[model samples]
Target: MSETNDSLAEEKELLKSVENAPASKKISTYAKLSGPGWLQGAITLGGGSLGGSLYLGIIGGTELLWLQPLMMIFGILMLSVIGYVTLSTGKKPFQAINEHINPVLGWGWLIAAMLANLVWAMPQFSL
Candidate 1:
């Protein structure tokens, strides 16, 4: 019993140390740590994923389990490309695009993305 309790305590301390160690290293190197949180929230809150989950729960049950895996694959592919572009240039995605390509093209893409998001927002609010 004492051995079990000691092992659990050691595991808890190891977990905390692992978590805090990365954060301390980032701070020491002046690296930004908040980007991952925003990236995670963006992926998790995407309309397609949420809609699929809701629709599956309402209509199809677990029969549509395959879609979730497909969505995750595509989402990771996109994020990987975005992260590569951002990291290679040390610029946010928007700035990198506008800097490498024409500002007009960059802004055009931004406007199109905004319009798509606006279309998505309408159904979200109605629901």
Candidate 2:
């Protein structure tokens, strides 16, 4: 009975500590927890996004201010779907796409990603 009481006291203390933690600390903790996914997201935001944003701003000015956020929401949704599919199927994204979707679409996506990487790298290489 004493050991049970002690274990209960320890559990309550742990819960209290978690409850008292600052909101910002909790957010930062979660960010650290998702470090690998965050890094992948950062890497995904490359020259293609920069170029797209530049063109959108140039062509539409403030009139298209909603476009960027809307696109980001859509991108996030698509990424979530991909993540879910990969997790549920235990398959790589490309393999899942090729096997479950269309093989041509998967190959085309791979080629497009490769071409975009080369295009973004060209100016850096020249410099």
Which is the leading candidate under lDDT?
2
The TM-score of predicted model 1 comes to 0.44
How do the predictions measure up, each by TM-score? 0.44, 0.58
Q: Write the per-residue lDDT of candidate 1 for residues 10-121, one digit (tens) a residue.
A: 7667555556567776464333424366665664566665775787767877787787688669857766765687777878788987887578866876896688567544
Candidate 2: 10-residue stretch with minimal lDDT: 118-127
Per-model CA lDDT versus the true structure: 0.66, 0.74
Off by over 4 Å in 2: 1-21, 46-52, 115-127
- Residue-wise C-alpha lDDT for candidate 2, range 1-127, written one tens digit per residue: 5996796697677556667698886676557546489776756676666776788899999999899899779868867877887766769988998888789977987897688667654433433
